[model samples]
Target: MSATQFFKISLKRSTIGLAPDYRAAARTLGLHRSHQTVYRPADSTTAGLILKLKELVKVENVASIPTSVEINAARKAARGYQVVEKQGAFTKI
Candidate 1:
């Protein structure tokens, strides 16, 4: 069987001050806030909605959907420190 494709849609701009239709389109795509990302099937209906909000969103074609863990990892901040080496008890700084 062939793998399903998805549209990785991220809201790059806010819908505020825009037409109600644009805001509704964003909501229909599950985007409630800026920078929020959502995955939807690559179909005509979704395509139309995306096209309507194209100016306010960023779209990418992904082969598969990401798991919650993967999504969380992507959104997680980098660790501030890295361990270079471990010191032995007899070693002096």
Candidate 2:
């Protein structure tokens, strides 16, 4: 099967109070907030976007684009019971 192509990009820095050009670049690349993960095609234009936002974003190569289900699964997995056990009542306690 043809492997699904995907590019993983994350916003590492805040665009607030930055130069207009830099902010525009980040916005153009669809990175409007911190810790934002955007999936893009594997191409030179995408690469250029990443480069432009490198100071404010991180670029990574991923196997494929993760769906909402996958993202939710990962978020669920990261919810440590011990960490938030005291914050809320247990559902099946």
Candidate 3:
């Protein structure tokens, strides 16, 4: 049989102060931040994890290993501002 394919699932939100079950699921998947990724074989366990944290996690198909490229790209896309300007002017000494 061919090598097992893995899915790269990320936690898109924090479980802090949320439902206990949701937080437990996130912890089980090793997700503790807004951009945490977990690699799991395409199996029932992984599917269960997805279902458990569906509201706080986002699942996507991945070829091999998990990478930050996809997550970073998503972050940039969701950003409302490209550059933040300072309110005050700079001074010289």
lDDT of 2 by residue, 37-58 (tens): 7888888787787877777777
Evaluate all candidate structures by whole-model CA lDDT and list the values in order: 0.92, 0.79, 0.77
Query: Tens digit of lDDT per residue, candidate 1, span 1-93?
Result: 126589999999999899999999999999999999999999999999999998999999889999999888998899898889997689656
Clash count (model 1, backbone only): 0
Error of 3 at 26 (Å): 0.7
Q: Please write out the lDDT profile of model 3 over residues 35-93, one tens digit for every residue.
A: 87788777888789789778878887766873579656766756476667667777988
Q: What's the distance in Å from true for residue 85, model 3? A: 28
Q: Poorest 10 consecutive residues of model 1 by lDDT? A: 1-10
In candidate 1 the C-alpha lDDT for residue 28 amounts to 95
TM-score of 3: 0.61
The window of 10 residues in a row where model 2 has the poorest summed lDDT is: 77-86
Q: In candidate 2, which residue ranges exceed 4 Å CA deviation?
A: 1-4, 78-93
How high is each candidate's TM-score?
0.76, 0.72, 0.61
In model 1, state the lDDT of residue 9: 97
In terms of lDDT, model 3 sits at 0.77
Q: Which candidate comes out best when scored by lDDT?
A: 1
Residue 1's lDDT in candidate 1: 19
Deviation of model 3 at 21, angstroms: 1.9
